[model samples]
Target: MRYFILFLCCFFSYSLQAQAPHGAIRGIWVTAQDSVLDSKTNIQKAVENCKKAGINNIYVSTWNRGRTLYPSAIMMERFGVAIDPRFGKRDPLKELVEAAHAEKIKVHAWFEYGFASAQGDSGAYLLKKYPYYAAIGPDGKGIEKNGLTWMNAFHPLVQNFVKSLVLEVVKRYDLDGIQGDNRLTAAPSLAGYDAYTLAEYKKEHGRLAPPINHLDSNWIQWRAHRLNKFGKDLYQSVKAAKPNVLVSMAPNVYPSSLQEYLQDWPSWLREGYVDYVVVQLYSYKLDEYEKILKETIQQVGSKKGQLYAGVLIGLEDGYRAKPELLKGMLELNQKYDLPGELFFYHAALPKSGKMLKR
Candidate 1:
């Protein structure tokens, strides 16, 4: 009887351990537009929903569209607007940090817009005030690609401005991490024709002008290197401010992330600039998701432990990932031994929650 009882206890313990999710950082992004941040009550509800869903981390958008979700002395000093006017003196980040921490959820301040200024507003308010920050294209106009207008990410002043925003959040908030998406250290591949960039290129290359072809191999490498350097600097700056806070990045998948947007995240990982990378592996198809997941695993090599898959759960256009597909993706993550996953937004948690429990 004693031996039989021991066997049963061991079997149940093994089963329970097997049922738990595979990673340390099961997370979700809470965007500024999400109603979860609309009030303290909503935030509490969101945190409870996350707890039930098995989400342990929340990436809250702090910066977007030339403004912050929290009151900012930086933006006030520069633009005279402390926070996004829509919230009216309420600091959603403060409320969210308190609410999420109460639930034992780690919060990361996400800089959603990064160096890009506006989506379709041509440079928006930031560039309207600081025209020199514009990331000029070969056409001698501000770079606009895929509806997002650019800032000169390679320029020193722009880099410092972005650094200041990140450091301010690190200093002000009691948070677990800080994050930047694809737009953070990345610029449209066609950018860098601005006068400042051109002058620097000329100075470096025996006083020669940059090639007219934006896709020139040498040009691509040079721009990617600049962005990579900025990423390292930004990572160091964040560490200097808060040694314990994780510096997370969610750049798009590699190779293309370099060839298209100049993100160079593999270098960021190899150099230890990012504590972990949540590669945006947003795919609606199961086979495609697996394909990319495999490729990502192979590319990261030994750094798999520092990787998290960023799944697309919902979109603003009312598209939700099918439950079975979400389940299959989680299974794939477990099969591949990826450390964790972060879904795109908060509203989709209930669907993922059900899938996670099952």
Candidate 2:
């Protein structure tokens, strides 16, 4: 029986490797901030726009700003609320999945705001229900950076709750993959001073946690390692529930991602935890963007097939790249032999729906 199970596993792995997209895995991210997801008409239009632009995959945001975009039994069970009221009973994810699948585009559930419970929204459901789970900072209060408040990434309760949220969707939805962005698996380096993490750290290391020095190399790696363990568990859990569903991550570029956000993505790839990785290489200057892309290529090395370049064609901050600039970025991706590219957003694509000429 064990040998039979091994054979099955080997066959599945081989099938995945064989089925990977031979051409670029052209993709786009649809974020909650766009609000286009609130209507079925908008979802259909969005999928059609992506199809016209040659996007083969859509990483739709499933969780954000303390609420889910889809009908979530897990959210309802935990918080007494299922979908974001703004959605008004509309399952945007389901709508997108159906539309995109009909168009032959794969859909991945993007958990954009993974551990983040709130962003300047004090009365968030998770925050109001379990305030104790919020991560504490050096100020000895719930840590809030750049208007975002994160749950204790190291707290067992937080990990279990968030994992359940992720797995819930995996079990309930026919998704092509599940994704974790920068904020999901990585926390601000200033966090983990919370009581739960400190106590847990002491138990493991036999000493109190370090003072709030964001640049503390040892301290940064320690917290990142904890998140890495979470990454491994998340990948395993998703695979266990749906062996064919891909596990993807789009983290900030390395070293900075490690020092500032405590994201150890390179290590995660080395450990074979995630099936796909898209390093966020958003730069306004083409030269700077290429430099980052070059470094990212070097970092991923032989694991090139598993990594993609996450280009920033547009941002909510009102920054949008010109068509020529976007084309240049795609050329660079092809130049480096990278598997594919994922735009930062769907709305960023030109309304004309024309594919960028290579």
Candidate 3:
């Protein structure tokens, strides 16, 4: 009788452990450039694909490049462009939300470009209309990095504009959540040299000019603090608009995220600015990916329950994540007992789902 009781206890424990990952978040991001949103039919098909793959959530890119996927009065009022011309009159966000909800899958409006005004346009569309909104570099030109042009993330005008965009969506859509990735409350560390930021810095720091070296520790902290405040405000605003709308962030791994982009997500997590975070741990190697995952787990510590690992499944350049590597990463996630994972994109769902099913 004693041995039988012990076996029962062990079996239940194993059963609980096995069921954990299934209950955890299984999410995928649907981007604007992907074919999944090209038509309403595609949106329905994508949601069906998600259901078959056991995905419970979808982060649809509502904002990207210099326009919105949905028709936006704000965009039209500000830039004379209501929606991405690529889709004609189709409202991708509305269609996607409807389709996903029909399948009982949660949808989050993802602001993919964040404060980025344009990509490879020399700030043509929105920036041309409001040039002062552009984040200025040390050379007195618009801040352009990695083919993306940015707005002044520290400026109140920029903050208000982004807040308006988020609130608009929250009020209009029946969304499960709203998400901001690496670019939302983040600015290139080399930024903050813009006239507005410089003046604000001077007012706070005894009228001293910002150090020429952008990498100065104090400078970085100050910029990061401003971003933290923006994050807090954004969170509060979203909650006020709809208390149930989850505020999610998908920033890059910490310390490096702080050093490169003024994204101090650790502080955001600590202060309750985000409901959860999916730290981007994309790597091609299993060992390196595991090492990073372990380090991230340690950093989050007691807050691991509010963390989700962001996995890169594939890129547009035909770089599909190997099934073995993906299986290994999922195993690592299981070993660490992570709460969930959010795949980088939707295009690789078939491959990823096959591995997940196995």
Candidate 4:
């Protein structure tokens, strides 16, 4: 009996050790240190630093703070700094492709899909220009009413807008892939069924929406389907634009609940919209995280790119990433044979950045 137990333990241990982190996706998050097209920019320096850090991939932000970081014609129609604004004209997307290519690092554009913020006088522009796009705030009114806003993904214009925007970015940049930001997504609101969206639903289903205070399970399920369709369509749009450009997404927590919330990540994966996925595993407990991560990875399997465990800062000792947590993630990579791990943000990484070095 003792010998059998020892053999079983040894077999599992051997299996764990022999398993290598498998998949093509590996790397870290990236953001602009400053303006997107600033002339003083040293693209090579930034890429080299990432390469030195052992990061083989860099997810670069192209838009934030009501600014589109790349030279975007779609954005020119939206944010009026200057048509073909000089920095807008600079084309960081192209630069990223070239620079990262030289370093042999894959570069994916990071887009905050459902959220947009304007920190300055531009706030009014968000309100007046795109009132229909904004979400309903806590008070059941447009976020614009509360001085906060994000585009309603359920809206057709919004869908077309995101699709076209993604196409244009990829066509211009020739990037390795595209990824969505986690917090940048919507919180799943039935209220976002704005007039246009209601019209769309009505048109499709041949009926008016369920009355307020009357939650229709069928309507909710159908709405969820529409959302999943939208996500798949987004993936299709990017692939159609550039067949080789990888489509990756970072979904909100709990895939099942999120589907109703509007993300539908599981369906996206099973149906195969995303080629790679960086799940946000910022939990504090090493043991719990490991189990959750392993199950998540196992669910993803070896066919799709090995899940890029989304390791982030601020999760207790995991955030500090001292002895156990960091080491454990690395160990998880080895045990699962995952593609590798990815950090959540560029600025959040250590100065040396040696922890993730290739």
Candidate 5:
């Protein structure tokens, strides 16, 4: 009886260790939009909560709503304030890095807004400063969708401007890595019809840009190719400036992300542009979530720990995911052989119950 009990303990321990290998990227995202980062005490409590939840990485927001969370020289020179006014002169990014590092957690500056100008600035500071830089749709209006305004990715000046924002963070902060998502390095498939982008396209292809039909296959591929080139350039730039700093991307699911947002992340991984790719598989149903997990495994083959799952813990719309759902998602990751995951936001973590311990 004693030998059987000992064997069972050893077997379970071995299984647990095998399921969770060393150096797995167990991360969670903390956005500036969260009120918890508004002060030093709140930020410390947030970091401590994550540490207690066994989070080892944090992807904090550096850019959002046409402002920066840190003291950005670029924004100060171009716009007015160096940091987001909601933060009240507090360097939340710096505080987050210090707090996370003290807890031995990795920090990545998530350029959440990337090339985006604003959601609806309505003649606000940034829009007033660079009105010409915003992207245009086929309707001859500013490219606005879901209330978000994006910058033209094909424009040389816009590309340089976005790069400067990212480089500023890398150079100014003691970060382990930098990241971009659907909003940063991407434009809507219906975008690129701006006067400048069209002129540039005509100059290269000897024709005006296509019409507003986003389903046009050739047009979609052409725009995606341009973004792909930008991705490669941005990747190289990040590495060139800081060779050891990791460059990561968390884009939406593939093919669909390409069709809608022109984010061909699998190709970026293949082209060696990203050090890590966190695929957003936010699903409410277990079967649907498991299906995406399988697809992620097939897509990220042989990369082995380079791809992490972006789990949706809670959303801003007051949607709190059940604890059982969260646990099942983690189990699916283990079954599919993925190493780790990053919850959408730290505030989504359960209040009292233990979650993600192993």
Candidate 6:
């Protein structure tokens, strides 16, 4: 019976490998900030694990603390948090990218813009340096949520500068792609449109600001457009700088929340800015995950690009997956012929690298 079981396993493994997704984006999301690249040995070990497991792509980093991982010339004053030669730090991005390429794996640089200053360090610097793009309350008071600082998206310069900094990474690195997390839509029903946005809105849209007490449709719509613009400009900038490299976006699934908190990801997908996007479905339930996957893929609507379904492995959010989870997910993959599946973070992959192995 044990031999019979083994036979079945080998059979499935070979069969799956024969048809494994290729020419399709497959990888895990990794970061280089808030955490150092696990020692070079570990970094190579992780890449080796991925190659052995048949994973072909990795999304790593270039920006943190409003600072670009690559050494900078422009952001030195506004958000560049480091100065010493260590600022560039021994070609961190290059080594990672090279390792991945050596194993036939592709590396895409991940950029988490919008919310800056993980703790209290960079927040205070940006606020004091550029109050124009810095956060302020409706009462015209500066807003601070514990330690997370936000950039004023309404400022044209803010958008341009952010896009340029991101472009710097694309220009400098031979990245396989760009992994962009559209993380700054702010919140729905969030208060404090502020005098900065109000004045800008009047000038751009030719309308007096609506009262904060009432939800403003025009304002919301305009914000969504700006969000779309960010994606458009960033994608174009990266592609223009490096034509072969792809672009990816990590966005939440809830549509309303995306519009209110994320600037409307649907529009970004439809408009063709994102080369690919992973809907962080973060689902634990087999059926629910499949449902969200179907819904998100439906949005791509014949656009020829990769759509990696983000799986929630460890956390139990109704989408918490267990042993049967991979089986169920593979069932969906077979049904739709999905290009690949993406786990939220590099650390989240099962210790054996077995689930995403095939």
Number of the top TM-score candidate: 3
Q: What's the true lDDT of residue 248 in model 3?
A: 91
lDDT of each residue in 66-128, candidate 4, tens digit only = 566676677666766522244645667777778888878998888753454443444446556
C-alpha TM-scores of all predictions: 0.92, 0.91, 0.93, 0.78, 0.90, 0.80
In candidate 4, stretches whose alpha carbon ends up further than 4 angstroms from where it belongs are: 1-22, 32-42, 82-89, 113-124, 137-139, 143-148, 183-187, 200-208, 211-220, 256-261, 298-306, 314-320, 350-352
Give one digit per residue, the lDDT tens place, for model 3 in 1-358.
Answer: 9999999999977765554423478899998789998988988988988999888999999888888889999988987888888889888898889989999999999999999988886236788778788898777777887889899999899899999999999999999999999999899988998889999999999999898898899999999999999999999999999999999999999888999899989888788889888999999999999999988888877677788899999998878899888899888888888868998789888667767542
TM-score of 6: 0.80
Show model 6 residue runs off by greater than 4 Å: 1-22, 33-38, 77-80, 83-88, 115-123, 136-147, 184-192, 204-207, 213-215, 315-321, 350-352
Write one digit per residue (lDDT tens) for candidate 1, span 34-111.
888788899899999999988899999988877888999998999999998888989989999998898889999999
Higher-scoring candidate on TM-score, 1 or 4: 1
Pairwise TM-score winner, candidates 5 and 6: 5
Task: Give lDDT: candidate 4, residue 2.
Answer: 100
TM-score of 5: 0.90
Clashing pairs in 3: none
lDDT of 5 by residue, 1-358 (tens): 9999999999977865554433488888888668667889988888888888888888988888888888888878877688877777678888888998999989999998887777776325665677778787888877776788777877888899889999988888899999898876788887888888787678877686575786688888888899999889999999999998888888888777888898878888778888878889999988899988888778766664677889988888978778788889889888877778888987776562267665
Better of 5 and 6 by lDDT: 5
| Candidate 6, 32-112: lDDT as tens digits | 542336456666887877776667888776666555665566666555544323444555677788888888898887776
Pairs of residues clashing in candidate 1 = none
Per-residue error for 126 in candidate 1, Å, reads 0.8
Which residue ranges in model 2 land beyond 4 Å of their true spot? 1-23, 355-357
| Number of colliding residue pairs in each model | 0, 0, 0, 9, 1, 6
